[model samples]
Target: MSKKNLQARDISWLSFNARVLQEANDPTVPLKQRIRFLGIHSNNLDEFFRVRVATLRRMIELGGKKGNMHLEDNPQAILDQIQMTVLQQQNEFNRIWEDILKQLNKEKVYLTNEQNLNKEQQEFVKNFFDESVRANIIPLLIESLPQLPYLRDKSIYLGVVMRKTASAYDQKYSLIEIPSKVVGRFVQLPSPPGEHHIILLEDVIRFNLPYIFSYFGYDHFDAHIFKVTKDAEIDIDNDVSTSFVQKIEKGLKNRRKGKPVRFLYDKEMDAGLLEYLIRRLNLSRRDNIIPGGRIHNFRHFMDFPDVFKAQKKERVPFTHPDLQKAQRVTEVILQKDVMLHLPYHSFGSVIDLLREAAMDPDVTTIKITAYRLAPASRVINALINAARNGKEVVVMLELRARFDEENNLEWKEVLEEEGVKVLIGVANLKVHAKLCVIKKKQGTRIIQYGFVSTGNLNEKTARVYADHCLLTSNRSVMADINRIFKYLENPKTTIQHLRNCNTLLVCPNAMRKRLIAMIDREIKTAKTKKTAKIYIKLNSLSDELLINKLYEAATAGVELNIIVRSIFCPKTDQRRFKQPIHAVSIIDEYLEHARVLIFHNGGKEKMYISSADWMVRNLDHRIEAAVPILQPAIQKELKDIINIQLADNVKARWLDDELSNNYVISGDEKKIRSQIETYQYLYQKTGKHSEASSH
Candidate 1:
């Protein structure tokens, strides 16, 4: 498909997020999960505005000097379309939230705000505010201040309109930062047996507004929530004098002063106060000034209280069958390759491998790459332990992992303090690949083994993110991993080492070309009237060249199966193709995060699990890896899982030409939910059965 015909990636992403909203509106979904879906949608939109929308604004500012950036349409036009879509989604979001509120009320659970509090609840809120919230709040009397204080991004503020009881015209405007970060956003209130009352932290402060400004003798108070989303793009200056770490720190500090791209508020906010606040923030009508329901930051609702009457039965991850009998994860992986389908297979094994390497006397070195890690990362702890155990531990931590920059900077210090060598990755390129290799001496011969994963080394996200990690002792794979690390260690001198990777496809050097070449081979086969097929699964698929190649293959009669979770751009239903590509997107309880590519290569099947998606940044800019799945059993397992997803009828949606996320039709076929089916597929391999498997 041509650039004009292909879907705009940003617009397609909004469609993907709409799928998230669909989940929130899905009555079949558990109530708690539905609420969490709302949170996910809100959080997703926040990042979209901060990054994607912010970039478009920059393009508009650049005017005629749009540079070499390939935009599908005019920036202003896209922004207008984005505004229209977002406003529509906001209405749908409000409706879903209202329905959820009614559901909560039916369960005798109340999300009571300041106005709806009963006598006992009012007294309870007053006491709670005085004891817990009073100290954290600092009300800004904006009418008197020379300039407004910096409005923090990702934080909600209560715009207060205070007036004398007797004088209707005399009023003062003030702002109070909701201390949601320090004191959490949700507070559980005391209630009678079999009933629950919950209050937002902002409401607690709202109830005591009179007490907060009592010295001024304010009698009437109206407080509504508003949030500002700032441009999150970090601009690192080129200064030979400043170190990379210093540059990163400076960039982070500058991010706080970024221009506002979005201003969202409760629609019922005081009209005058809203106008004053917007004017002071310098946001114009052209900006994403959105009005919504009472709740502004629904992202916090992801952790809504566990007070539902019907409890969800949590699925416990089980050990991989190959590792079930082995005393050590290291030993099993050393014997044969094992692929871990996360959330189905326990992540503890990945952690255990590092822990074992840390304590093993034969182990001499451990090298790993980290992009985003858990808050309390056991992987980091294990590396630190290895360092303390006299093993050389090298960690290539990407300091520019988008929103995790500050956290990674703090981690760099902790790791360096523990004697672990920390590498902040190559300049202008993020080390997006998840790779690790451990060297151990066995009778004067070195044995290397580790893993390459499609997800972050985060224990917290592992329970929900669907990902793949392959633990192997394969010599070629390990050698390629080591070469990539060598390139990372000294990119200026070791660029050839990255270029020489043979077994694995390394990006910025080979993956994109290799992928295109593979597509050409399939096309050739299809033209010769052979059975040619390609299967792909990725979080995104928007790179132009690859899409064009896939279009070519489709024209040559190549059978394609595409399972993309988000941000798809290809026109799958073009008229010239022999058959339309079988494309589906699955959004369910678990996040579909793994990247897999399969080619029929004239019936000699080839498979790979990758850390990179088919996006321009991932293919040509970032350092990435895609390792071949050589083990037959593991390849079959991966194929089976992909097939299960392709056959899904419950949660899967068709990615048609219109970008309409319609549910996949089951017709006469039996029902299949991929995540649940995947669990059963793996669990049955262990020669065991459970209620969860049947779920």
Candidate 2:
């Protein structure tokens, strides 16, 4: 387990995804949730192909994986490993789907197709198709046209082969785009009172293929599902002649027509049609052509109909005690720091803080950074309202957030139109720091308070993404925030401002150095036989320098704990090390998205909630922030959450050398599902606080 022999980034990601597949395969999970896990795995793999695999392919195409020092593995080797891993996972996925369907049958639920429908159900489906789907779908004759229609990425299509009954040579091929986004994917049909019947949108189209091509008078038809995943990495060149916004706009268009990274189709699809598609698309074996089940896009299954009976009590998110009945979120923050743990804590306080600033006449300025936003975002609405109220509102909205670029661009337009000063931020370094600072005037005194979060301020994701947002009026923190924003506004002239920040770790050139210094201290303390421990929770930890530092600390006998959600590259189980590190990953109902690091400084404990993971890109190429937890109460609360996760035996999986993804078995011990227990732990506190406030 030398640091030099670290896991390949792509291979590590595939292992992470294998954990997700394990969730889908677990029989202990609720049936609906299991199905959703399948969808999540599918969606995750699609993105993996589009980004990571796509990048590897490009590297291979540009000669060999030689000059690129960033690549952890040879491109060809990683690509081959990916294909093997993905095919194995796909087999498991199909098996899980079959098992789930059987379970659904036990519940008197049936997923019907064109051939299986009865008279009434058939009529219902046909009517539903005519009324809703037909208008939305456009069938393209594939071979008849000189060139194929540009297939929309992530959308499923019904690859059709129509033949005249008398002549096999007179067959035609066409593609019908499934109108799932507009019409819907799963359509319910008339059935017996005790039984439920659902038909896929593609099957409905398949039933009416003859009618769709009535002009051609085709009698026989064979249709199957297929989808294309194109390279999603947008290339923004350093061309001074074009504006940054213009460059992004151009990149977006090019992204749409990006070289195909993967083409997945039903295994039952006709050999002729599949070959035709491969030829037209000019796909090589490197393109990752995969044959899967009838369903090409299970992601829509995430929105599966709620027809099944409830199997477990649904958990509810309670309001945080600090902001429960507060008159003003700003007022509370001014008095003391308030840490809001997301999903377990309602995100209303964030909106309230902004809304209060928007309406408060004394509020003079508001500054925030946005990476991803929810549709019809209350955050944006508050910002726009704040701008309208004559406050100096500034937003550093990163329009380069992948998959969110289009929406962010639209958000940029609205914010600019509403008179909000928008900064796109320094190119090559995406502004990813989740920060907000609001300044108010009170009788010639200026005061500032806002929140710093580990996740996006997106209201939608806030309901499911586990994160921490600290609302505070710490003067030093406010000073550092302003300094970072100043640097962002004028990076060329004022990069030194960020370097001077005393309270916050600003990334690109600062955080990495600080973290390394901290790790060095831990190693020194461990060598002296004094107590030393480092606990970290991050989305990923792939930076070579940091991983090697952790290894050095591990060899020095410093206790280490790491909970990474994805792309972990370190070798934690080396026998040469003095101690085995505790590393686990939890994939439960709530996404574990927070990044916290704790360093036991001999006796004095230091903890920080960061906007950056240990990934090289975040540390060296992105604007990130990490703020110290000065409040003892907030620090202890974070420690409690981390300890709970560490003790979790139910959902946590060992990040061992084998990547076997074995559950931390709770044999003869009390079972602890950290997500549920954490919710209860925080929620019960709300009642106690309410009683105290009333008294």
Candidate 3:
């Protein structure tokens, strides 16, 4: 594919979010999940603005220096496209929300604003506000201030125009940050029997605006919700005197004062208040000044009340067949490698492995890499237990894990206090690899066993994120993991350890080079007219060099099947190609997050599960790893799952050149939804009677 034909990464990302919006619009999807999909789309877009949009704005500021970055389109052009795409998505979002509201009302569930509340709800809102919200609110009188008060990112603020009923001229512009973080976004109100009435936290505040600002004696108030998404880039200074942790702490503090990249407000907001906000926030039209509906932070909708009568039939995860019979998880992993397909299989086994290692008399050391973790992480708890049990526990926690920076920083202190040696990772490189290594002294001979995964060690996300984890005691893989930890221990001095990794493909050293070589091999095989095929699954694929190589392979008649969930940049269509690339994106209840690569090497397939996407940052900037699927059975299992995804007619969108996001329709074939089918396939293999698949 020509570079000119390649989709811009940000544009492709928007298309991916559009797929999410499709899920929300899909009537077949459960109403609850459809609402959740809206939340997911909103959350994804917020991050896109915070990071991708923020980066483009920076590149535009850099001017000619952006050429060094090898961008496909001008930064300003991409920003303009992004703004247009976001506006369109927002319109679609509003339509879907309105439709959902109708459906909700049909189910006798009402979402009412302050103005639409009944007398009973008005009393409840007042009581709820006085008891729950009164202490948390800090109403700002913006007109009295010399400059506008600092508006926090990821928070929604109610822009108020308070004036006496008789005199519209005597008005005060005020801002009230919704205390949603403390009091939640959704407030349940009393309703008629068997009916549910829900109100937004902002609406609850709006209903009590009279009491909140009664001292000023304002008889009328015009309040509308607005949100500001700031540039989340942490500018880590070159202050050698400060520790890495201190730099992160300082960077996080500075991030609060970041430039506002996007200012989203209700279109019905008071005109004067909107103008005041834009001028005071120093945001121009180019800065994504978007006019949205009444709702600003739909992210809070992810936790929308479960008031619907149709409850989601939760699919309980079963123990992996290989682990079910084992006395201890360590025993099974040490004997044979076991691949745990998350959400379908229990994550408790992983914690069990760590806990067993902690209590085992022979165990001596435990090492793991953490990128993002759960709020109440069982993995962290296990590691902490091991530390208290006198085992040497080293956690290479990445403090720069985007929004999880503060949480990880707090974890760092807790780990250190518990005697666990916490390594904050190397300078200028985030450890994105998910790996663990435990050593047990077996009669003077050290035995190593642990896990390698394609996702974070977050138990909570494990339930919702489709990922793969390999529990293994393979000597070479364990050695490579240890080598990676050594580099993290002393990055400047122990760089050789990272370079020496053999079994696992280590990024920023050999992964990219080796991946290109693998693609070249496939091209050579295709030229010979022999069977040459590659199947890849990733959350994203935007690396230019790798994309170019794939294009060359396609031109050489090599068969390629790609299942990318987001940010796919490669154009599957090319006139010179001997065959078209089969590419699709899956969006469903579970997050399709695993990264897998398969190479049909002369009938001997080479398979790997990786933590990295094919993005330039994952390959060239962050520390990542991909472990080979050594066991034939495990490789076949992974291949089966990939095949299931490839055969999906439902929830799979054809990734065409136009980025139309058309659903993959299977004419006269079974309607296979990949996530549900994969779960059934794995569950059946457990030799237990399978339950019906649920969304």
Candidate 4:
């Protein structure tokens, strides 16, 4: 592949986010939902800088120009482009927010600032500030302090400029960190009978500036909302003696002091104040300094108050029919294969299976590899209970799950205390695979039951993230899983212990090679004039080697289609590949997170549920897994889900040659909101709900 065939992964990710921004701008969406989309876009950008941009910066420092030679533009140049694009997006975001606010007002809900408060609203604001906000406010006198206080990454701050009326030149600068984390960002005020009123915490603080700075002997005051996004990449020291958990803990502390990658302030901020902040923070002009609205952390909108009537929001969430009240989850798995589609299908089935395995006298051992887990994880509890029940419970807890390292470490300590054998991942490689295997005695034999998922076993996230989990009692796959656990326990052990895996694809040693080989087979079939097609749904697609191979397969006449939720670096131009890839990204009610790959192996199709994306880290550095969907029923279900997502004309946006997020509208035809439609499909299939009688 040549330079023109590839797009920068970072740029491509931004394009995907632009698709999210398009959702916010789409008037067809509900007002509240649109604001939530804006929040998601902002939150996504924050992580991109903290992790991805930080990695690029480190690469530039280590490899210099030579490292960036393969990139279409240098890191600095890409940063500039990101800044420009973000600024434009910010402008659009403000417009959409204003439009939403107007719609909200028409619905009898008003968002007012400090200056727009009525007498009753003023009383409510003052009381709320006194009771909730005053204790959390810690004002730092900037001029008097000896050392500058370190600002937290992605935290909003208020820059205060205090001027004394007695002397024209007597002025002081101060800073106050917004306690949005403690007291909620949105404050509801008593409204006139039949009206709803709300104010931002920033504005509430803005309302009572005199009360906070009464001791400062200043008669005049002004403050501007500002925020800084720092590089959140954790750099662990390579010390042999330090435990992986300790290293992660130490690295998390170091994350707080990371260099700022972006600075954002209110557009109407005083020019002198902005300049002073830039100088004091040592922020270069190129460090993505943006001018945003008064409110910086719109991510709070994700938890926006449900103050209105129940009917005002989207319809009530439905439980997945298959697992709504599964009485014998493990028994069903033992008898036949079961597939779970998250959000659409309840994640309770996974939990119920574990719980059953814990209490089952026939079960002897339970093993799993965890990457990211929920805060109050039922998964961990079930494993602990299994260990307490005298079952051999082995858990490979990856301590290097970025941003969740601390939580994972805490879980590790808890699990270890509960007598569960915990492995803190393999050396130099993070175990990114999500696998759970249970050994149970049935009749005259010990059967191995296994589960493979495309997402973390986190119930909290499973409620909103679209993922797939395959539960199977296939002997061959279970043996391969046993081998994986053995290798994880002792890296030097030969993987030859279990090689009868004709149904699964394990990574690091074989996944990439197997995937390439599969593509090659498809290419051969295509050349022979047989029906050849390949469909992939992944979070990201950036590995150049795999991408180039995909292009080759595309040129060989394989029908290629991709549904990437985040990043895609492949060019869809005619000059680059023989066929233009049909690609779209769906940013809808639920996050599209599953990694599924389907290939037309002659007439019979092959489907897989993978814990790995087609990224270099997943393929080369991490211990990942992608298990083949062997059951015909499960394969058909996976294919159906992918097809539903592809047919999404409402929430799906095309990833075009120019990377513009153009909505895929089927022009006045039936609208298909994939998330909702998928939920209905699963509900109907499982007979989870009964129909209402005709009136």
Report lDDT (CA) for all predictions: 0.93, 0.88, 0.91, 0.83
Worst 10 residues of 3 by lDDT: 64-73
Between candidates 1 and 4, the one scoring higher on TM-score is 1
Question: Tens-digit lDDT track for model 3 on 1-695?
Answer: 45586888989999999999999999998898899999999999999999889888888777767543545458888888888889999999999999999999999999988988888888889999999999999999998899888889989999999999888689998899998888899998889998998999999999899999999989999999999999999999889999888999999999999999999999999898999999999888888999988887887788899887755566778899988888999988888999999988998999899889989989999999998999999999999999999999999999999999999999999999999999897776789999999999998699999999998999999999999999999999999999999899988886889899999999889999999989999999999999999999999999989999999999999999999999999989889889999999999989999999999988899999999999988998889999999998888899999999999999999999999999999898988998888888888888987765466
- Which stretch of 10 consecutive residues in model 4 shows the poorest summed lDDT? 686-695
Which segments of model 2 are wrong by more than 4 Å? 1-4, 64-69, 688-695
Give the top-scoring candidate (lDDT): 1
**Quality of model 4 by C-alpha lDDT:** 0.83
How does each model score on TM-score?
0.99, 0.97, 0.98, 0.94
Return the TM-score for candidate 2, rounded to 2 decimals: 0.97
**Model 2, span 1-695: residue lDDT tens:** 34355878778888888888888888878778888898899899989999998888878777755543355446888889899999999999999899999998998989988999989887887788788888998889888798878999979999999999899799889999998988888988888998889999999999999889999888999999999999998988779999999999999999999989899999999999999999999898767899988887998888888888865456656677877778888888899999999988889889989999999999999999999999989999999999999999999999899899989899999999999999886967888999999999989899998878999999999988999999999999999999989988887786888888898898897899999999999999999998889999999988889998998999999999999998888877887689988899998878899999999987789899999999878998889999899888898999999999999888899998877888999799998888877877787787742111100
Residue 618 C-alpha lDDT in model 3: 91
Question: What are the per-residue Cα lDDT tens digits for candidate 4 across 1-695?
Answer: 56567788888888888888887887777676677898898898889888777767666676565542333347767767787877787888889888888888887888889999989889888999999999999989887767678998867999988899889798888899999889988998888887888888989998899888898788888899999888887778889999777888889999999998888899888788899889888888777788887888888887777665444334334544444565788767777778888876678788888999999999999999898898889999999999999999999999888778888888988999999999987766779889999998879988899798889999999888888888888777787788888888887666554233455676677788889998999999988878889999999998888998888888888889899998888876566455788888998778889999998988788888898999887887788878888788778778888998899988888877788888789988888878767766666786555342110
Which segments of model 1 are wrong by more than 4 Å?
Answer: 64-72, 310-312, 693-695
Question: How well does candidate 4 match the true structure in TM-score terms?
Answer: 0.94
Residue-level lDDT of model 1, residues 1-695, one tens digit each, is 45675888899999999999999999888888999999999999999999999989888787757554455458888899999999999999999999999998999989988888889989888888888889898999998988889989989999999999899988999999999989999999889899999999998888899889999988999999999999999998989999999999999999999999999999999999999998899989999999988888899999999999755456789999999999999988889999999989999999999999999999999999999999999999999999999999999999999999999999999999999999997887889999999999999699999999999999999999999999999999999999999999999886899899999999999999899999999999999999999999999999988999999999999999999999999989988999998999999999999999999988789999999999988988899999999989889999999999999999999988898899998798899999999998898899998567322
RMSD to native, candidate 3: 1.3
